[model samples]
Target: MTVALWCILIAIFLPYLCTGVAKVSGGYRLKDNHDPRGFLDSLEGLGKRANAAQLNSFEVTPAFAAAVIVAHLAGNAELVTINVLSVLFITSRLLYIIFYLADLATLRSLMWFVGMGLIVSFFVVSV
Candidate 1:
C-alpha cells in the first residue's frame, strides 16, 4: 500500500494512543472501563489535555483519511506529493498532541492548522 494509505491507518489509531496516555496517567483501573468517558472526564492537566487531544484526533481523522483516499482515487496529484503531505499531517498531529500535553496552546493550535492545511492540500492537489 502507498504511504498515504498507511497514514490513514495511523490517523485512525492515533486517538487510541492519546487515550491510552490519558488512561495510564489518570490512574485508570479495570472498573473504570465501566465508565470510560466519565473516567476521562475526571482527568486533569496532562491527562485532561491528552483526552482533549484524543477527541480532536478523532474529529480530524475522517477528513484526513477521506482526503488521502480521494486524492489517490482522483489520480491527479503526484504520489510523492500526496505521500509527503500525508506524512507531514501525521507529524503535525504528533506535535499537536505533544504541545497539548505540554500546555502549549499556541503551538498546539498552530499544529492543528498545519494538519488541516495538509488535508486541504490533498484535495487541492487532486484537482
Candidate 2:
C-alpha cells in the first residue's frame, strides 16, 4: 500500500496509543470503571497531556483524511511527493505526542505547525 494510505492507518491507530498512555499514566486497570471522561477529567500532568493528545489526534484526523482523499482524486500529485508529505505529517504527529507528554510546549507547537503545513501541502500539491 502507498505510504499515504499507511498514514491513514497510522492516524486511525494514534488515538489508541494516546489512550494507552493515558490509561497507564492515570493508573487505570481492566476492572476499573469505564468513566473515561471522568477519569480523564481527574488526570493531571502526563495523564492530562495524554488525554489532550488523544483529543488533538481526533481533531486533526478528519482534515488529514480529507486532504489525502483530495490528493488521490486529483491524480496529479507524484507518489513520492505523497509519501514524503505523509511521512512528514505522521512523524510530526509522533513528535507532537512525545513533546506534549514530556511537557515540551515549544516543541509540541513546532510539530503542530509542521504537521499542519504538510496537510496544507497535500491540497497545494493537488492543485
Winning model by TM-score: 1
lDDT of 2 by residue, 1-127 (tens): 8889999989988988998899899999776676777887889889999999999999998889889888988998998998889888999999999999999999999999999999999999988
Give the clashing residue pairs of candidate 2, or none.
none
> Per-residue lDDT of 1-127 in model 1, one digit per residue for the tens?
9999999999999999999999999999998899999999999989999999999999999999999999999999999999999999999999999999999999999999999999999999999
Per-prediction TM-score, please?
0.98, 0.96
TM-score, cand. 1 vs. native: 0.98
Name the 10 consecutive residues with the lowest summed lDDT in model 1.
27-36
Off by over 4 Å in 1: none
Relative to the true structure, candidate 2 reaches a TM of 0.96
lDDT of 2 at 117: 93
C-alpha lDDT values of all predictions: 0.96, 0.91
